[model samples]
Target: MKVEIWSDVMCPFCYIGKHNFEKALENLPFKNEVEVEWKSFQLDPTLNPSETKTTVEYFKEKKGIPEAQASQMVSQVAQMGQMAEIDFNFEKALITNTFPAHRLIHLAKKHNLSSEVEEALFEAHFIDGENVGSIDLLVSIAEKLGIDKEEAQKVLNSDTFDQEVNQDIADAQNNGITGVPFFVLNGKYAVSGAQPVETFVNALQQTYNETVSPFKDLSDGGTSCDADGCSI
Candidate 1:
């Protein structure tokens, strides 16, 4: 079975959803048969890297929420992160564009290191509070995942994965996906948001059970009609 996840690195729920999904996968009997692919989705493509605001400040300004309320909102998210054992440092999070980070993910997919790269990027942005838009930072993250430094640097330096990243976004749009942490199983079932582990497990189990490996013969071929003759 193949699972495609549409997510953004800056999304807090995406990070939590990953953990939940992994836990569900661990409980699956056929876990080894599952293939997961992370697709790119940018929460804010128009964001400027030069902006120095943290996530809290960005929410305050953009959403017109009070500073305290913004902080409270982040605190609520932190509580959610705690449930998944994720330490979210939203106070220090850099509110920058994630297009470059998404590009790195696409590059990692070619090397079969997409999962590692996605985890590192999520940890960098949500936990370590690093600027994910920085090419230097993305290259360093890729290198840490055992990817060739030169290859990662070259891809980052140029717009090599730009089209692929955009295509992922376009595909998500075409699929009618309006949010992050969207999980599609076998292109037939979709589970959206940071659902509980049981939800994921049920989806997985349901998909597995509903799958018919071989067609069942309902009746014997006692009589059949052909172009030549009909058997009675």
Candidate 2:
């Protein structure tokens, strides 16, 4: 079974979804056979690198919510993250343009270290509160993960993987995905949002069982509606 997840490192639910999916995989009988790929998905493609705003401020401006409400909402998210064993330092988190980070991930995919780099990026941005948009920070993280630092720096400085990152975004849009934490199994089954562990486990098990053929469409064409209207 192959699972391609379209998620952003800055997304809180994406982090939680990663944990849930990993837990599911840990209990799966065919864990060793499963191939997990972290596809790039940016939450803010238009954001400027010069922009300096906390996630709370960004949410307040984007959603037109009051500062107090935004702070409460962030606090709630922090609590939820704690429950999932993710330490989210929202206080120091800098709302960044993730295009560069996505490009680095594309480069990491070539080396089969995409998952490691993805987790490092998420930790840098959400937990460690590093400026992920910075080229230096990205290169530093890449170096720590055994990726060629100088080569990564060159790639980051240049627009090497920009097209691939943009293509992933375009493909996500074409597939009707408008949010993070979208899971695509075997290029067929797609479950959007941070679904429960049981949901992911069931999908993985079903996909594993139906591996007799190369192309298996596991998605049932079900409605994409959640409690808050149709999921984007």
Candidate 3:
């Protein structure tokens, strides 16, 4: 089954959703057969990558909510992170444009290291409270993930992978998606937000059953050959 996840590293819920989604996969017998692709989506595309503010400030400014409300909401998200076993340091989290970070993810996808880089981005933004939009920071993150440092720096420094990142954002818009952590299972079922682990597990099974071929009940009559001998 192919699972495409539309997410933003700046969104704490997206990180939580990733954790729960991976946990759900662990409960499945066909876990290894499942393919997960992280698609990029920027919550605030217009924000400048070079300029960053605390996540709380960004939330208040965009949502037009009071500081108290925004702080309360942040607290609620912190609790959710606890449930997902992620230690989110929102106070330190810098909010900036995720476009550059998304580009790095696209670069990682080329080497089949997208998921690894995605997790590192999440940790950089939410846990370590670093500016994910920084070219130097992104290159260092890629280096840690076994991606060639020069290649990563080149990709991040130039316009490489920009189209792939833009295409992902365009896809989310074309699909009328207005939120982060939107999951598409088997190119059919859609799960939005950080839903419960059970919800993900059920969706995985439903999609897998619908798409995968079932085992044939050949033990009753059909003949087969194995290392030991051929059935007579």
Question: So what's the TM-score on candidate 1?
Answer: 0.90
Question: Which residue pairs in model 2 clash with each other?
Answer: 178-232
Q: Measured by C-alpha RMSD in angstroms, how accurate is candidate 1?
A: 4.3
Clashes of 1: 0
**Sorted by TM-score, highest first, which candidate order results?**
3, 1, 2
Q: Which wins on TM-score, candidate 1 or candidate 2?
A: 1
Best by lDDT: 3
Candidate 3 lDDT, 170-232, residue by residue in tens: 999999999989999988899999998999999999899877755545476677899999988
Please give each candidate's TM-score.
0.90, 0.89, 0.90
- Model 2 scores a C-alpha lDDT of 0.87
The CA lDDT at 81 in model 2 is: 81
Q: Give every collision pair in model 1.
A: none
lDDT of 1: 0.90
Question: What does the lDDT read for residue 92 in candidate 3?
Answer: 96
Error of 1 at 79 (Å): 0.4
lDDT of 2 by residue, 75-98 (tens): 998888887788889999999788
> Which 10-residue window of candidate 2 scores lowest in summed lDDT?
208-217
Better of 2 and 3 by TM-score: 3
Instruction: Give, for candidate 3, the lowest lDDT window spanning 10 residues.
Output: 212-221
Per-residue lDDT tens digits for candidate 1, residues 89-165, read 99778878888888899989998998889899988988788899898999999888888899989998889988999
